[model samples]
Target: MAMDTPFDEFLKEWSDNIDKVRTGAGLLSKIRDADVDVGTTPKTLIERRDKVELFRYDPIAERSVDTPVLIVYGLIGRYTMADLQPDRSLVRSLLAKGIDLWLIDWGQPGRGERWLTIDDYVDDYIDEAVERICAETGHEKITLLGICEGGVFTTCYAALHPRRVKNLVLTITPIDFHADVDDPALHRGFLNVWIRSLEASDIDLMVDALGVIPGEFMSSVFSLMTPMRSIAKYNVDLIDTVDDRDKLMNFLRMEKWLADRPDHPGSAGRQWLHDLYQENKLIKGEFALSGRKVDLGAVKMPILNVFALDDHIVPPNCSKALGQKAGSKDYTEIPLPGGHVGLFVSSRSQGGLTKNIADWLTARDG
Candidate 1:
């Protein structure tokens, strides 16, 4: 055979690329239409309120730790992401480590819930759930693990009822809203910049008009934050792993979680934006859960603050501030290396971050 010409090589390479695209399209179709099962880690519903449900995951190990963990997710997202898939599940990893986990599923809000405020969430729902978990586990105080805005709730609860929380864990949670205001490195944090840009009247008008912030609206905002994410990342990533079934499914599972957004209650949304985002009341010790001021100094329980170094939704500075503000004598701030969602599902986080949480809890496990 004659030596292959440059033109021949170029044609062959182009043809190979075309074949990959065709294969990727077929895989994408299956992902779009296939019935994919997620949040398969078994959990039992322990309690239910209007739209909130408390789910307790059975221990995968023969025995569980003395103190249990209660996972509270952000209001705008489903808790299912914590247990998205067996292999990539924070819930699974914790359970396998004998850590009993109870999750709060703040179900989709309705028109009636529009009047519900953080007072209702923290004083009523979260308190009741904590009581239920304590009763079940025969432990007076449970480890409070909060994710994102849920972290705000837990922090409020810990301050209000410090005796009820044995150890507090905040993952990608913002403690000081204005902590990164002067940090050029964290200027890319879209949520921080976007919220700060809005005037108080603008926030009030939006919440008042919508009643509840539409889940679709919030999801669209998230998508717009990084336009290339919606357009380029998926196409490039899918192509890279088009022939790999497991990788494609992994991607599809994450997409499913991101799409599963929940409507935030109007009153709560108004308070959150105005008080925490706008006024920076949380760090200033001016935030009120119901009628009482939430004092960060009351967070005396052993605390673990896990923040992603590359987080844009809640900048690392916002999360790291917990170490300085909380009253915990044993406060630890873990600086991770990813964005908000990546902490739970990314390959870099598979065993690393989850193990860190488990070990931290275990060290203080009574």
Candidate 2:
């Protein structure tokens, strides 16, 4: 056995520094010319209403499931995350499995849409989209696949119109908002605690004054949940990924997605922060839309609840709570290893996540 001399150690350090500099320079050059545009999978615009547009992905493989799946993403972020890139796309993965896919794009909402509320989104937009999908496919019902906040929208929809949804799939969705209190870990449910700390009047005042909640403001709040990581992402993490082309591309694509946050409408934002986050209305069966109470017990359709094991934004307990509350007899909860966004984009989760969804829907396609 031998040990390195001081001179040898110094030479090794010098070589490492040179490699770092070379990698950093190459990263900067790639940033200057990198094509980081996302959501490139081919799809057709099927319908449009106000700022909401519904798209149906062009089939890449033979259809196996008779019922189509409608993906609904929340207003805070675009649906681009689902189809970020060809290699790391949830949309493409499901499509490759012969599943018919459709998605609802809640377009960039400005002051004009500030009047919209949860009722308009669930009752009007989602309902209409479901109807359109059913009519187009000549099927009586279609699957509702919701992501994050969009999962709540779909859950509300399925509860309100059970017969319209053949199956419900929720990923990184929070059913019991206050379930984070059970864990009480600092990394988990910071959003819930922050929102609960504010008064209802505070939410009203902000929405009334701003008309729409700025996307950047929400993004900053999310950053506060994992402050250290947010800081390191641009510095240490970026440097670490620079040496690998695929990893660097993934990093840039994520940065591009993070930068494209959309402003949330005032009324809906108010209900979300106050009614759901603060009051815990949805889990309590008190959340209502269009003068109708949203009862989780009314969610009679088969449900596949997918939660991330290490999700900090929406805690595992919060999502797992759905298994006990939902009205479905065949409810299944699958916990994957990753954060909220990683459930959709991480290579580790890509296989299990897609297979679980495709397989679940296929079995229930009766």
Please give each candidate's TM-score: 0.94, 0.95
Across 1-366, the per-residue lDDT of candidate 2 in tens digits comes to: 243798888888678767976886786686653488699999999999998999999999999887999999998898999888998899999999999999999899999999999999999999999999999989999999999999999999999999899899999998899999989567888888898999888888889999999999999999888889999998788767777777888898998899899999999999999889998999999998999999999898899999999899899999988888888998998999999999888999988999999999999986
Per-residue lDDT of 359 in model 1: 90
Q: State the lDDT of candidate 1 residue by residue for 1-366, as single tens digits.
A: 353899888888778778888887887677653456678888899999998999998778955467889999989788877887888899899888888889998988966798999999999999999999998878999999999999999999999988789999999999899888866783356787788899888878878888898888889988898788778766677777776778878877877877878889999999888898888999999998768999998899998999887887888888888888888899998888888888888879658888889899989987
- Give the top-scoring candidate (lDDT): 2
Worst 10 residues of 1 by lDDT: 28-37
Scored by CA lDDT, what does every candidate get? 0.86, 0.91
Off by over 4 Å in 1: 1-10, 28-34
State the weakest 10-residue window (summed lDDT) of model 2.
Answer: 25-34
